[model samples]
Target: MELKSHSPFIKWTVRLLKKALYIITPILVVSILVTVSYLKQTSEVISKSQNEAIWFVLQLTKEYSEFIYQLQSYQLGTSDYNDMLIQYEILWSRFNTIVNNSLVEHLHQFEGSITEIDHHFTYIKAMEEQLLQLPRTKNESSLLLLFKNDYDDLQIYLNHKFRLSSDDLGNKINAVSTLEIIFRYLLISTILTGMIIAYLLLRESRYHHRLAMFDSLTGIRNRLWLNKKLDKLAKNNQAFNFYLIDLDGFKKINDTQGHHTGDIFLRHVASRLRQLEQPHCFSARMGGDEFAVIELIQLNTSGATPSLLPGKLVSLLNSSTMISGKSLTISASIGISQFPTFAKSIPEVLKQADFAMYEVKQQGKNGAAYFKPYSVSTMKNNPLSSVS
Candidate 1:
C-alpha cells in the first residue's frame, strides 16, 4: 500500500524523463550533424586554398624562368631585343595579375608569402630600364647574372613559404578531423545514455506494476490483482470456486500484541494459503486480515467436492504460530461462493461470499459457510461484524 501510494509520483517522473529524452535526442543528433558538415566544408576549403597558393607560386617561378630563357637567347644572338622585351613584359604582366588577384590576398595569410613576392617584384621593377637595354648595353652579361641571382632567391623563398603553407593546412585539416571524431563520440555516448535510461525506465515501470498487483507486506497477490483475474475468468464463462477468508481474533492481536505481531501473523497465514496454490488454483491477500482464493472447477477432474477445500483452509489457518518468542493462535471465518452457481458476476460473487463470511462471524467465527441467496438481505440489515 505504501508503494501503491507513491505510484503517482513515480509514474509522473517516468513520463517526464520520457518526454525530455524524446525532445532532446533529436536536437542533439541534428546539432552533431550540422557541426560535422561545417567541419568537412572547412577542411575542403583549406585544402583548396593550399593548392591555389602552391600553384600561384609555381606559376611565378615558371614565368621568371621563361624571361631568363628569353634574355639568354638575346645574349646568344638567337633572339632580338624585341623578343626579349616582349618576354620581360609578359613576366611583369603575370606578376601584376597575381598581385591584383583575390587569391593572392588569401595567400597573404601564409606567413607573408605575398609580401615576399611583392618585395621581389619591386626589386625587378626598379631594374626594368636596365633590362630593356639588354644586347645593346655593354653591361648585359653582368645584368643577366644579377637578375638570375635575384630570381633564384625569390624561388627559394617562395618554395619555403609553400612548405609552411602546406604544413599549416595539414594541421588545420587534422584539427578539424579531430573535432569531427569528438562530436561523433559525443553523439554515440548520448545515444547509448538515452538507451540505458529507456531500459531502466521500462524496468522500473514493470517493478511498479508488480507493486500494484501484489500485497506489499505479505508478498502475495493483492485484491486488485484478484479482481482482474476474476473478471477475466468470468468474462470467459469459466467456472471457479471463490473463497473469501477473514482472520478471526486479528484486531485483538493488533490491540494486545501490537500491529507488528499482527502483521507477522498475517504473513504466516499468507504463507499457509500459498501452500494451497496449484494448477488453476490462485490465492491472494485482499487487505488487512482478509484473503481470497480461486479454483477452476474444470481442472478438478478427480471430482473433489468444494466442501473439502474449505475444511482444509479452516484447519491450516487455525494452526498456532510462534511470534516474538510467544505462542499465538488465530482462526479464520471463510465464505464459499461458486461462479454461475451462487453468482454470475464479480460484484455479485464477492457480495455473496461476504454475506456468508458475515454469517460465520455471527455464528461464533472460526468456521466456513456457503452463500445462500435468501440470507443476504437479513445479513445486510445487521451492522458489520467486528473482528474478534
Candidate 2:
C-alpha cells in the first residue's frame, strides 16, 4: 500500500513540534546546568562531613597506644584513671554522632559508603561501653591480679576493632572515587545544556528586534511602538503626536467574566487594533487595557500631546457584545495634547495630558478630555482632628 498524499494537519503538527523542541532545548540546557551545580555541591558537602570522623579515628588510635601505660600508672601509684576514661568515652560518642549524621544527610547515590560506615559504628559503640566499665574493678595491691587479665583482654579487643574499622574504610575509598567520577560527568552535561539554550535564546532575540513595540505579555508590537518608531518620516525634524488608547470598564470585564476570559478579550482587542491600523501606524500595549499608536509618515507640524484626534477614538473602540458567553460593552476615556502647543517639553506635554485624563475620570466614565490649564490647590483647610 502506497501512502502518497500529504496531510495538511500532519504537516502543521510537525511544524508545531519543531517549534516546541526549539523552546524546550533551552530549558533542558538550563536544567542541566543547575543539576551539575547541585552534584558538585553535594560532593563537597560529603567530603567536608567526613573530616570530623577521619580526625576522630586518628586521635582514637593514638590514645589507644598510650592507654595501657596510663592505666597501669593509675593502678600502681594512686593516680585516677577517670580523666583518661572520660576522654575516650567522649571521643567515641562524637565519632558515632558524625557517622550517623552523614548516613541521614547524604542519602543520594553518592552516600553508599557513608551508610556502611554507620553500620560498623554499632560494633564500635559496644566496644566503647565495655571499655568505660573497666575502671571500676582496678586494684593497686595485686600486680598480677584478675583485673590485669581483664584489662589486657579489653585493650586487645579495642585495637582489633579499630584495625577492622580501618580496613572497612579502605574498601569505601573506591566508593568515594566512583562518586567523584559521577559528579564530574553530571557537571559536564550541565555546561553543554547551558550552551545550547544560550544559542536558541539568541536566535529568538534576533527575531524580536524587528518588532518596534512589544506587548507586555505576548511580546508583539503595539500602536505606541508604531508611533515612537525611529524609522518614521521625520527626516527634516517633523513633529508627531503620541496617542494613547485605553479600554474603559476593562475592570468590569475582568471582574465580571473572570480573568482567563479577560485575557482572551484583551488579545482579541489587540488583534482588532492591529488589523485596523496600517504598517505605518505602529502600536503597543501601554499597560492593562491601554494602547499606543504613532504615525508612519512624518510631517513638519508638531504631533505631540494628547493625540485623541477628537472623536476619532470614540468611533474606533465603541463596539462590543458578549465575551466568554457574557454580554459586554467596552468604552474608553481619551486624553490628548498637542505637540509644542499645550506644553513646551515632552515631559510637560505628558503631564498636561495625564491631568486631563483625571478630569475625564472625575466628570464621567466615557468621554475624551484635552489638555487645559487648571490651578491645583496646594493647600487645603486643616479640619479639626483630635488624633493629630
Candidate 3:
C-alpha cells in the first residue's frame, strides 16, 4: 500500500489561508488597541477643556460681583473709596488674565467671543476716571445706575457663553461615545470572524488528514494507514500474519455492469471486511479491488488462529451481493505472509504476500496460498501474473 500526496492546489490554498491568518491577526489586535487608546485620550482632553472653561468663567463672574459689592458699600458710606478702587483693579486683572490664558483663547475662537470681551474692556476703561471721581460728583447716583446696567449686560453675556460652551462639550462627548461603541462592535466582529476562520481551517485540516489515511470510496482504512500499522508492529517485534486479498473477476464485473455497479460491489466487499475487525485483527482497503488484513498471532490464547483468517476472508468475499437489481457473485485470492519470519523488511513482506496472491490466481481463480521462497520460480509459468 502506497500513500498519495495532496494535490498542489489544495496545498497552496491551505498555505495561503495560514499566511492570511498570521498577517490579519496582529493587525486586528493593533487596530483595536489604537482605537481604544485614541478614544481615551480624546475623552480626557475634552474633559480637561470643559473643567478649565467652567473654572475660568466662575472665577471671572465672582470677581465682577465683588467689585460691584465694593462700589455699593462705598456709596452707602460703609467702605472707603480705596477699597472700591482695589476691587476694580482686581476685576481688571481678571480680564487681563482672560487675554493671556491659552484655554480662554481657545474658547474665544468659537464665536468671535474675543471681540465682544474686548469691547466690554474698552468701555470699562473709558468709565474708569469718572468712576474714580464718583464720591465728589454731584450726579453720583446716575453714574452708579449706568454702571449697574453695564454689569448686568456683562453677566448676561458670560451666562450665554457658558451655556454654549457646555452644550458644545456635551455634543462632542456624545459623538465620542457613539464612536467608541461603533469601534467596540467592530472589534468584537473582527474577533468573531477570526475565530470562525480558525475553526474552519482546523476542520479542513482534519478532513485532509482523514483523506490521507482512509479510502474515500470504501470508507475504510487506506494503504497509508496499513503501512503505518505494519511499521509499528514490525518495530515492536510482534508476530502477525498479513493477508492480501484481491478480487477475482472484478474487472469482468466492471466491464459488464459498468463502473457504478462495480463501485457498489466494492463497497459491499469492504463492509464484509469490516466485520473482521477486532482487538487482534485490522482490515484496510489497499486500493482498487485489493484489500489487506493484519491478525496478531497469539500462540497461547486461541479460539481462532491467524491461519484460519484466509479461509474466512475467502468465504466472506465469495458470498453473492445484490447490486443494481442484479445478483453479482465474486471470489477472492488471498496471499499470506508472516512478519519477522520469512520476511524481515516491510517491502519483502508485501512482495511475498503479492507473490502468494498471484500464485493463488495462477492455480485457478478462487483460492489462497502461503508464501514460500520456492514459489518465486513458479511466477514465470503463470500467465495471469501481469493481469492486475
| lDDT (CA) per prediction | 0.79, 0.52, 0.77
Candidate 1 root-mean-square deviation in Å = 7.1
Ranking by lDDT: 1, 3, 2
User: What's each prediction's TM-score?
Assistant: 0.68, 0.38, 0.64
The candidate that wins on lDDT is 1
C-alpha-based local distance difference test score of model 3 = 0.77
- Candidate 1 TM-score, true structure as reference: 0.68
Q: Over the stretch 19-47, how does candidate 2's per-residue lDDT look in tens digits?
A: 87677666656665665676566556546
lDDT of 3 at 229: 93
| lDDT of each residue in 19-42, candidate 1, tens digit only | 877787787787788878888788
- Residue 238, model 3, lDDT: 86
The candidate, 1 or 2, that scores higher on TM-score is: 1
